[model samples]
Each structure stands twice: as structure tokens, then as C-alpha cells.
Target: MLSPGDTLSDFTLEGVDENGEINTFTLSELTDDAVAVLNVYVYDYSPVCTDQVCDISELEWLGINEDVNVVGISGDGPYSHQQFIEDNRIGYPLLCDTAEEIIEELGVLHEEKDGLRRVPQRSIFLIDSDRVVRWKWVAEDNWDEWDSGPIEALNDTISQIRA
Candidate 1:
């Protein structure tokens, strides 16, 4: 896992824009915002994963922190991500890791189900403007069970940044 102050590697991924158009997004473009919470999930429809991403969207700090950005990522295709975002009314951006390149780059690709590729692990990375990892968390066994008090954790990280 990456630690605070570690520079994130340049990675490219395919995602769907708000207009539902296929687009390629690079790490550089992603970190161009103020702060980003990169939530990596296993699949689109999974229970735990959905809660993690959706609840994060409802985090109150995001509305107050103008410089904060958040994006959910999964190995699924853009079409699936698009529909999932729409159905769930996901307010933030979702990245379609169709090629699994970002997952591989982040060293989280898992070989589950004998031959199928599964999400490496459930984790969230807080990246700062300079592309340095500021904080992170990894779910033990299931993402749904992972809880650090969303608002509290986010508040702590943001407070640290402000200090």
C-alpha cells in the first residue's frame, strides 16, 4: 500500500464522461483538482462496494470543500459504470477500468475465481494537489464492513490538511 508523501504513479484509464462518452483519463488529469479520494471497488453492483462509494458521495465535506474531488473506480466497462452511476444517482465521477491497467499499476489486481480477474482489494486513497498520497484505508475482508466513521475520518484528514 502507498503511504503518505509517496508520489502516485502516472496511470491512464478509460471512463465515461457525464455525457456518457468514452474518455481516457490519466492520473495527471485526475489529480488536477484540489484533493481527490480515489475509491477502488471490486464490482459495480456489489453491496459493500456500492455502500462505500455512495456513502462517500453523501459525505458533507465534499459540498463544503470546493477543492475536494472524489472518483470511484472498478474494472467494469464504461457502460456498466454509466448505468450504475445513473441508477444510484452517484454524484461524483466513476472511472471504468476496462483494461485493468490502473489496478495493475496500483498493485491491486486479484486473481480470483480460478481464471477471472477480481478487484485487487477495497481501498481508498486521499491524494493531494501535487499527486502525493495523503492518507489511505484498506478494508479487511469486505468493503461493506469497512467503516472508519466516514464523516469523522474525512474530517480528520481535511483538518490535517488545513493545519
Candidate 2:
């Protein structure tokens, strides 16, 4: 499993930005001298996942320091992500992992969602400019929903990193 201090894998993915624009996002964009928060949610429209995604955006205090790129990833396609973003007024990039490729690579696949196993477990990774994952969190139960804890912790971690 990819753990803290481990470099994230390189991958190009289609995602919906805050403006609902479709764009190609490469992991290297976050690695090339940028701090990032990579959030993996199960589905786009689900209640818990929605809360998890939006929570990261609503935390304005985190922006009191350096900018941290907040990117959300899910098995949902770009279209679905766009709608989700519009519906919730989200202001971040939400990436698609429809093939579960990145989810599998991250080692956070829920493993029991589809017959072939594609759903991603609710998780978060705090990766630094060097691509090293500084912090990691994965839900213990697939059914459990995420609160502000992850993003709040992310905010705190960002503060520490920029300090």
C-alpha cells in the first residue's frame, strides 16, 4: 500500500473544475512544486461524499496561508462530477476515476462495490510539492461517512507545512 513519504503515481485524468469546465489533470501538476489535498470519495451524488467534497471548499480559514490545491476523485464521470459541483456550489477540481485505475493504484479500492470491484474507499492523502504523501487517512468502514475532520486536518497540515 502507498503510505506516507511514498510518492504518488503519475496519472492523467479528466475532471470538472469549479467553473464546471472539463479539463485534463495530471498528478504532476500537483507534484511540480505544489502542495495538494487528494480526496477520494465513493460516488459523486451520494450524501456523504457530497458533504466530504464540499467540506473541503467551505473551509476558508485554510486559505489564510499558502494555497493548497484541493482535488476530489471518484468513480463518477466528468459529467456527473460537473453536476455535483454545480449542485453544491463546489469550487474545486473533481476528477474522474471511472476505470478505478487510480483508485486501485492508490490501494484504496473498496473491493466489494462492484462484482468486478471498482468503488474507491473514502480516503484522503496530503501530498507535498515533492509528491511525497505526508499524511493519509482511509475510512475503516465502507458505510461510514466523512465529516470535516479530514479537511480540517488537511487545513492544519497545510498550516504546518507552510509555517
Candidate 3:
């Protein structure tokens, strides 16, 4: 998996914007002039993934840090991401990685039991304005959620990084 201090390569993806419009975006554009929290998940509407995304959406620190951009990326397609956003009232953009290119590049790709399905291992990346990864968290298994408490712990980490 990508580690802290590693520079991220730029990649383009089609995603559901905060306004619910599907548009193509590049990593540089997303992180421009700000730090970004990239939440990489297995699937769009899965139980743990839903909890993780919602917790992030409800983060109080998000209101305080205008320079921090939080986005979720998953192997689901743009339509699925759009529906997930609308259904959950998610506040941030969610990127589609249908081709699995981004997840493979980040070393978080996972294959299902049937060996016909692939997805990302639940992961998070804190990338600075310069595209250097500042911090990261990768779940050991697909079911593993945040250990230090969900929203508050993640908020604290982002807070410390900004500080």
C-alpha cells in the first residue's frame, strides 16, 4: 500500500460531484491548493462502507477545515456512486474506479471469493497539496472499520495533520 511521504501519481476518474452531477476529475484538480482525505472503499452500498462514508460526512472538523477536501473512491461505477450519494445524503464527492486502475496503483485491490469480482480494500489516504501522501490507514480485512473510534478519531487525525 502507498505510505506516508510517498508522492501520488495523478489519475483521472469519473465521479459524482457534490451537486450530484457526473463529471471527470483529475487528482491534481481535486487536491489543488488543499490537502485531501481520500477514502478508498470496497463497495458503494455495503454495510461497513456506508457507515464509513456517513461518518466522514458528519465529521465536525470538516466544517472547520475549508482547505481539506474529503472524497471517497470505490470500484463501483458512476451511476452507483450517484445513487449512493443521493440515498445517503453524502456531502462529498465519490469517485468511480470501475476499471480498478487506481486501486491497483495504490496496492489496495482485492479479489472476491469467486475470483471474478475485484474491489478495493478499505483504505484512507491523506494527500497534501503537493500530492505527497501525509498519512494512511488500510483495513486488514474488508470488514475492519476504524479502530480508534470512527468519525472523531478520523477527525482528530485530519486536525493534527492540518495543525
Candidates in order have lDDT scores of: 0.75, 0.82, 0.83
Candidate 2 clashing pairs, residues 3+ apart or interchain: none
Clash pairs, candidate 3, are none
lDDT of 3 by residue, 11-92 (tens): 9899998779999878898788878888898888899889888878887656677888888998788889888999999989
lDDT of 2 by residue, 1-163 (tens): 6798788878899999889999999888866667878889898878888778788778785355345777899889888988898999887899988888888878898567457865788899988887788888898876676666766676677778878
How does model 3 fare in lDDT? 0.83
TM of each candidate vs. truth: 0.84, 0.90, 0.89
A best-first ranking of the candidates according to their TM-score comes to: 2, 3, 1
Stretches > 4 Å off in candidate 2: 61-66, 113-116
Ranking of models by lDDT: 3, 2, 1
Candidate 2, residue 78: Cα displacement in angstroms equals 0.9
Per-model clash counts, in order, read 1, 0, 0
Q: Which tens-of-lDDT digit does each residue in 65-88 have in candidate 1?
A: 777777788878888988888788
Estimate the TM-score for candidate 2: 0.90
